[model samples]
Structure formats: C-alpha cells, structure tokens
Target: MNSGAKDRPSTSFSGVIRQNFATKISLCLLMALTIVVGANYGWRRGLLVVVGGLLGVALYYSSFGFTSAWRLLVFERRGAGVQAQLVMLAIAVTLFFPLLAVGEVFGQSLQGFVNPVSVTVALGAFLFGIGMQLAGGCASGTLFSVGGGDSRTLLTLFSFITGATVVTFHLPWWKTLPNLGAISLVDQFGWIVALALSLCVFTALFVLVGKFSTRETRSLVDDGPVDWLRSPWPLLWGAVALALLNATVLVLSGRPWGITGAFSKWGGHALHAVGIDLSSYPYWAEYDFGRSLLGDVPTTTSLGIILGAVASAGLLGKFNPTLRISKRGAITAIVGGLMMGYGGRLAFGCNIGALFGGIASGSLHGWLWLVCGFVGSIFGVFLRKQLGDGPYRNTQPQVEAAKP
Candidate 1:
C-alpha cells in the first residue's frame, strides 16, 4: 500500500501546533458543556450527547452519509458505501432485536419507531428523498454539514425547519389516509425470528449491490501513523460506530436516535415568537409536547452533532465557510429543505429516524422508507441535473480509498 499523507506535515510546525491546541481546547470545552447540561437533564441524556458528538466525529471523518451513498449508487453504480450501510444494519439488528423484545432496558420501557404503513409514509419518504438530494444532504447530513461550515447547508436547515413547522398545521388531514397500523417483526414472531429476517434482507442487498456495481471496490481507509485521529476513517468502521452508538441511545433514552423532530419544534417556536399560534394544531397542541420543544433529548443530540462536526472539521483543517452560492443553487436548497421538512413529518421520520432507527428496531416501516426514499432519490438526481449551477455537483472532495 502507498504511504498515507497523514504521516507528512501539511503546514509549518507553528501552524500545526496552533491547530492542535485549538482542537484540544475546543474539545475540552464542548465535553465540559455536554457534561454540565447532561447532568442537569440526567446522566443518561448527558451520555447521549457525548455519544452524539462522537457520531459527529465519525460521520465527518468518514464522509459516511446516506445522501451521497445513494446518489453514487444510482448515478455511478458504486456500491461500497451502500454495502457498508447494510453492514451497519446487520450489526444494529443483532444488538437491538433481543433488547427490544424484552421490552425494557435499565428499567425503562424500550420501544421502536414502528409507524403505520400507509400512502403518506410512501409519499413522504419519496419527497424526503428528493429533498435530500436537492438540499445536498439528509437530516443528519444537514446538521453535520452545517457544523462543518458548508454555508449552503445552513439554508437547507432553515428551510427544513420552516417546512416541517408548516406541515404540522396540516397533519390532521393527512392522518385520515388509509394505513396498515404499526407492525413490528419482534411482536409478530419473536426477536430471534426478526433478527434472522433482517439478516436475510441485509445479505440479499449486499450480494445484489456487489453483483451489479461497476466501480472498483476498495477499503474505506488507508493505514498510517496518526491516521486514526486526523485522517478520514474507514466507511465500514463509521457504519459500525454509528450503529452501536444509536443502539446506546435506545438504551439510555428508551428510544432510538431521531432527527427532524427537533427541527419542527424549533420552527414551531419561531412561528410562535411572531404571534402564530401553532398550539391550535393537533401536533403542538398535544399535552406538553410544545413546551418540550425548548430542550429535550433529540434537541440535545442534534446540537451535539453540530458541535462534534465543527471540532472534527477543524482538526482536519477543513472548516471553511463561504456566502457565495449560485442563484439556482440557493433556490434548490430552499425547495429541497421545505420538501424534506414536510415529508419527514408525514413519513414520521427522516433518514435517521425512519430508516436507521426503524430497521434497527425491526419495524417494517423502516424497510418501506428505505425503498421509497431510494426511489425518490432517483428522481432527485434527475432534477438536480436540470437545476443550473447545482452546489453539490462535484463539490465533494475526493478522498483516497485503499485496496481492499
């Protein structure tokens, strides 16, 4: 194998030292803040934030994103990243199915996001898929990218919040649509049977993707001194880390990790600040759900993701932000973000909530979300091509992939 660049110096010793110290100080402060807030919220919540930060690090360092993985597979026939995702699913199911079947973890009731299979779920996921590609990121992707100082992603985040909040006012009518109620494989047969089923699906996808892919396969990272901390991580390792971390969230929070909910809550609050009464809507009007918007597990974790991403990008000397964006690109981001927000609400989750959390929890809706979301991404890709000066086009830096 060729030597990795991690061993070489990219700048003068003085600059390297300054950056290293800055990263160290930033990490210390962030950890301290997480501990303080988490302590106030509860130790479990605190742990979740720390884990979320680690997730940010893993996500940024590895470029492990749902949007790019799906896009590359659809447009270029590369399946390495997609295969890694299946690997993550397999790992998660093995850990989650048994724990979820028992119905409790650390004395708290355990549950999965088993939403009803319905027309809304399909359409919502499809819309989310299109939005993801157009916005240049999915829910998790938006947060991390913003943290990493991608200025365009900030627009996506704002529009996502706005769209999600607006949709909440209309959700009552959408729920009237016909649906097959929440179904869980764990409840249907048993955890063991469910795990087996999930494995079968994972294997089938793995084989099918590999068989059809045209790009040369490679390991996600190259081995070198100090690469573990500063260099991009392996995609396989990133998948494993995220799966395990998400399962940990389930144990601590008594539920799986989620995104978008916080965005909607934030958006709703913003609307309320301007005298818009969202509480009239069934969503925010329900019990203390509106107040919970101020701060909660989901919001905390989302914040931690941003923090972790900032630190991770800074360490890698990649935290560059710019205001310049093409007019068409700006328009695409707004439209994409709006669609994602609305779709996430109707579908009951974003990629993280519905797909990752759903499948890990052995919910059939997650599988359906995966299929529908991927299909939506196909259309999104075509739309992106038509949109002039698309920001995401060829903007992602090429990271070296080693021979497997």
Candidate 2:
C-alpha cells in the first residue's frame, strides 16, 4: 500500500491544489475590494477598479511591453511588438473617432487628452524613451511588472515617484517654452477624415515594418492550446483587450485612460504628509488637489491594475517574487525610473496617457510624441550598450519567431 502510494503522483495533485488555492484567494480579494470601493465611492468608480484589474490581467498574460517593443525594433530590427502596437492603435482610433465625434455619451461629455505640440513634449518624450530602455519598462510596464512580482521594478517605481514630484517645481518653466498649442485632427478634419487618415498611417507602418524587419511574420494566434485561465495569451489578444479596455474607460470616465497622473498625485500627497506645502505651486492649485488626494478615478484604476496583475500571476502559478538585481541593473532601474517619472510629467503623460490616448483621440501631439520618443529610444539603446547591458537581448524567442 505504501509503495502504491509513492507511485500515486501526489506531488502533481498538491501543485494543482496550490494553484487553485492561489487563484481562489486572488479572486476573493478582487471581489472584496470591488465591493469595498463600490460602497465607499460609487458604482462607476468601483467598476473602473475592476477594469483596471482586467487591464493588469491582460497586460500580464500577454507579457505586452512597450519598452521591449521599442528596444527590439531599434536593436534587433524586430517589429512584432511594434506590429501589435499598430494593431492596438488602429483598433483604438476606430472605436474612438465615432464616439468622440458625438461629443457626449450617456449624458457624460467626452474629452481627449490633446495637449500642446511643444518643445516640452519633444524633450520630455525623448527623455522618456531613454528611460524606457534603461528601466526595462514604461509606465504601464513598470506597474504591471511590479504586480507580476519583479522586485527590481519596485525600486524603479519609488524613484519614479520621486522624480515626478521633484519635477513639479520646474513644470511651470517648461510650460513657458515654445509650443504650437493643441491640434486635434478630429476637430480640424472631422471624425471621418481623421479616421481614414489614421488608418492609412497604421497600414503604411504595418507594411513598411513588415518589409524591413529581420524577423519573419508570425500568426498572432498561439500554436499551442491556450488555457484561458492559466496560460499566456497571444500578443494580438493583449492588443485587442487593451484597446477595448481603453474605450471602456473613456465611456465610463468621460476621458481617455491615463496612468502617470496618478503617480504625480501620489507623490504630491506624500510630500504633503511630510509637512511640505504644495498649495503654493501653480500646478497643484489649478485643480482640486486636496480632493484628488483623497481619491479619484486614476488612483483607483492604478491600484486595480496592480491587484489584477497579482491575481493574474497567481492564477498562472508564477507569483514568485525575487529581489535579484545586480549593481548595474539597480543603477539603471533608479536612473530609468527617475527619467520616466520626470519625462512623463513633463510630456503631459506616459505611453498610455500621451501616446496611446493622444493618438487614439486624434491629437497631433501624439504623432509628434511617437517621432521624438522613437528617436530618443535609439540613443537610449546606444547608452545601454555603453553600460555593458545586452540591449539586443531577446527574452521571449517564441514571440519574436526570429529567422535563422
């Protein structure tokens, strides 16, 4: 009987039990938090939190990363990630154009994150590109990666917050710099024309990248059987999910999805807690900073993203947290985080808020951001090489489907 018991594969059973238990706990926590947020805030805010969680799950399962996408494109001439981004942007603009043209939905007035195409945007986005390469993640990347148990990103987040806070003192001066002001393609050309123009650009980029990239084009669908609950999702799945989620956020919140503003808010509150007076700052005074510090959509959604990522990781049986940063890696993380935080604020947003939200909404600044940020990323890749980091390293070979 003991010999038979030894052959029963109890270890596999225990592993299943553990995975199930972790999944259950994650779900329960998510449900409880949702209820709490609903009870304290409103149902709308609570729903946004749930959306944030799903964003995390989508981000985690797909391992979708803007940072790696840019680096791979620059270093290895691989464009799979870039292609996925194009798909996401195309989907986003399609959904956004008609809705924005209407101006109002469900009694809520809609607004795009259109900002000035200024020197500030160029400088900020350029710096942000370099930060992306150094930090190994962008704003959304850092948050989701932290939620996925990457301990190094934790340090990056802290430094990011610090950098964002420190930059607020100088933002007023940056604003004084030359700017072309806001340019909305939607407003200028009407939604129909804007949509067609945006789609043409996306198609052109898709074709051009496909032609030049060294990697062979691969199917977005996973070849292996995918367990929706536990297995990794295909890149296209992540792209579609993100685009839809952003649309949902716009419908619910009356504005496009944003991430970095919450970081600024958090940093502001932290400084206030330490006896610093922020009311004097023009940037802080322009809004209901006190009310925002209490709670807001961006804050709740950001929290939800982290929780959702944790749940996603737990469900996947990959929630092993480790603080294994080498000295060089640690330096880069801090420096990168600081640059990202500062650059994000200066540029009016990070990848999600500025590039994704801006472009989808037909803001010209979004296009400017793309050009400047990509240029900056080139220099960043060079810097990474100088620092002795493997800028061309490919962590996920299957995703790239590289040519021999």
TM-score to native of every candidate shown: 0.90, 0.90
Give the best candidate by lDDT.
Answer: 2
Model 1, stretches more than 4 Å misplaced? 1-29, 217-226, 287-294, 391-404
lDDT tens string, model 1, 1-404? 23333323337676566556646765776688677766677778788788788888888887788887887776667888899899999999999999888889778788888889888989999999999988879999898888777778899999999998889888889999999999999999899988898899899999999887888444544455437677778788798899998988899889899988888888877777788765667887763534544247788788788888878877886665568777877888999999999999899999999999988988888989999999998889778867743423444214321211
Worst lDDT 10-window in candidate 1: 395-404
TM-score of 2: 0.90
lDDT of each: 0.81, 0.82
Query: Where is model 2 more than 4 Å wrong at Cα?
Result: 1-22, 216-219, 286-294, 390-404
Superposed Cα RMSD, model 1: 4.0
lDDT of candidate model 1 versus the reference:
0.81
